[model samples]
Target: MPKPTVKVWMEEGVHSAIFAQQAVVGVFKLPQVTCLCCAIGLPPVHPNVHSTQKGRLLMSSITSTQVVSLSSQAPRPLPFWRRWLRKIEWRLLLLPVIGLLLWQGWVLLAESGYYADFIVPHPDTVWARLQERWADGSLVTHIATTLREALSGLFIASLIATALGYIIARVKIFDYLLTPYLIFLQAIPIIAISPLIIIWFGSGLASKVVIAAMITWFPMMIATIVGIRNVSTNLREMMRANAATHWQIFRHLEIPSAMPELLGGLKIAVTLSVVGAAVGEFVSAREGLGYLVMYGRGISDTPTVVLAVLMLTVVSLVLYSLVAMLETSLLSWRKAGKP
Candidate 1:
């Protein structure tokens, strides 16, 4: 038998394109065929050579049982747009593609003299600045500083907020006393009091972490209080009726019920933590992206500013994604249990 060449083709209604086995599958004789529409249990039809005589013969020889088996093995392909909608890769690319197009258009207009170049430097200019900073090794240190502050702040806030919120929600008396204090805290602008915080904590990592924690604590506290308090009354009673202890009830019932709100708060907290870290760095910092922003502005370096902003945006996105991923993994049971 001649060693056969095989081409893979899309089948109707499938989310993904699949290739046939390159080697012959005993009686299946996959390698003898030029195309594999029959392998996907479809009639021999191709946009190209998939509809050749060999494909038709392969399809014709299949018994009804084998056809059903093959069909069951692969879904029919969806139309191109449907395929895009069904998968994340293209949809995620869409916005970035549009943004890049708009940016390039602006760059073209600036180059054509419709807009001043100083208004915003070209993407090339920004890329050059990023490369320079990366090569100098400053970019990593700044990002690490900011990330360390933000993550540390978020961690501290989560522990304190969860414990305090639980106490307030369960005890009720502390709800009135502590909730008012948190409201007062949130009401105060972080910038207005940052100087005092910096003075107290010093112009170091301590101040940055304190500022980030202050910015993050209120929302997470609210989320924790709301989530714990919102546990189903029926569930509480049912647990009591079953003589479940407080620990078991909290572990099994309250935590699961409150997960949605807690996660919601965490999403908000993570982003705010980034903002707080930046604000702290803005007010007083030796290094970090915030420092880069200030340094760029001082020197009228648009590319440097933009690059720093983009890195900050990337950091914000990373923190948010981590929370989103955590939410998906933790609360997947709710989705799975849905009818």
Candidate 2:
């Protein structure tokens, strides 16, 4: 029996064609043969031996009909516009596009004083207040304080949660001991025990950082656990069959396989850290964005309150963006997995 031969073809680095050609003549036969390559699963370029240019070229150019043409002269390397189109197909623009549109709508609505009751004030008024606060340096101080606490909390939470998650996923004893308590913590709202946190740690940076950590920990924990546990069983078996040590299995296979989930958890942690910091400041703090908001609300300065809220939102967005950028950098291997 003659073995099958494959001709792999590419056009501008994109998979263009895969041809299966036979070497022996009438001794062996292939029934219902079909070309296996196309750009993103479209119909094969050469279906019949006489239909398209690809088919005509294949049939007329080859004396034996046993030969197959993988592609047509490397396809001219694709035009610039076509390359751009391919890139567009490769990347996702949906979430950012929707977010920008929503942001624009919010700006327009805020300026129009449409939801001017207790929710949001006019955008111009908010902007004016922002400028005034900026000039006085209080806004900058507030933003800095809040961001410091949020980042501190996020760092602590990510470290602890990721470590614990890896432990619980890999160690049955740790999972038994800690999983239920972690779940309980996740279920409990930080707002419900604000008084306790303030009483224990005081209305200082410590309390704020702790609050942020508490809020951010659960999601990271859950994501890490799922990710670590979700490594393909076949891959695990392969590693074990090769007599790989436990550490080797984890370092080589488990960590990389679970990275997507870990990054996902980190992204959630980033947004939650901002919210936690603000909530802590809102409940009990001398300085920070939440304190500004509390101060504005106390005096019925709706515009100032609106400005603080907007600033907090911008902070969350910035943190989330940073996390997303980090995720992309760390998980370049998952580009095909990304939508």
- Top of the candidates by TM-score: 1
Q: Give the TM-score of candidate 2.
A: 0.67
lDDT of 2 at 203: 94
Clashing pairs in 2: 110-123
Model 2 lDDT per residue over 1-339, tens place: 344443333333544343344533222122212323333233343343322323221322222334334455434446779878876743456878887897788778766765754566655667789889999999999999999999999999989988899999889999999888888878887988777898899999999999999999989888989999999999999999999999999899998999889888888888889899998998889999999999999988988887888899999999888888888788887667678
Relative to the unseen true structure, what is the C-alpha lDDT of residue 15 in candidate 2, on a scale of 0 to 100? 42
Best by lDDT: 1
lDDT of 1 by residue, 194-253 (tens): 889988998899999999999999889999999999998999999999999999999999
RMSD of 2: 9.9
Clashing pairs in 1: 12-76, 12-77, 13-76, 13-77, 14-76, 14-77
Once model 1 is optimally superposed onto the true structure by TM-score, how far is the C-alpha of residue 305 displaced, in angstroms?
Answer: 0.9
The 0-to-1 C-alpha lDDT of every candidate, in the order given, reads 0.78, 0.76
Candidate 2, superposed: residue stretches over 4 Å from native:
1-120, 337-339
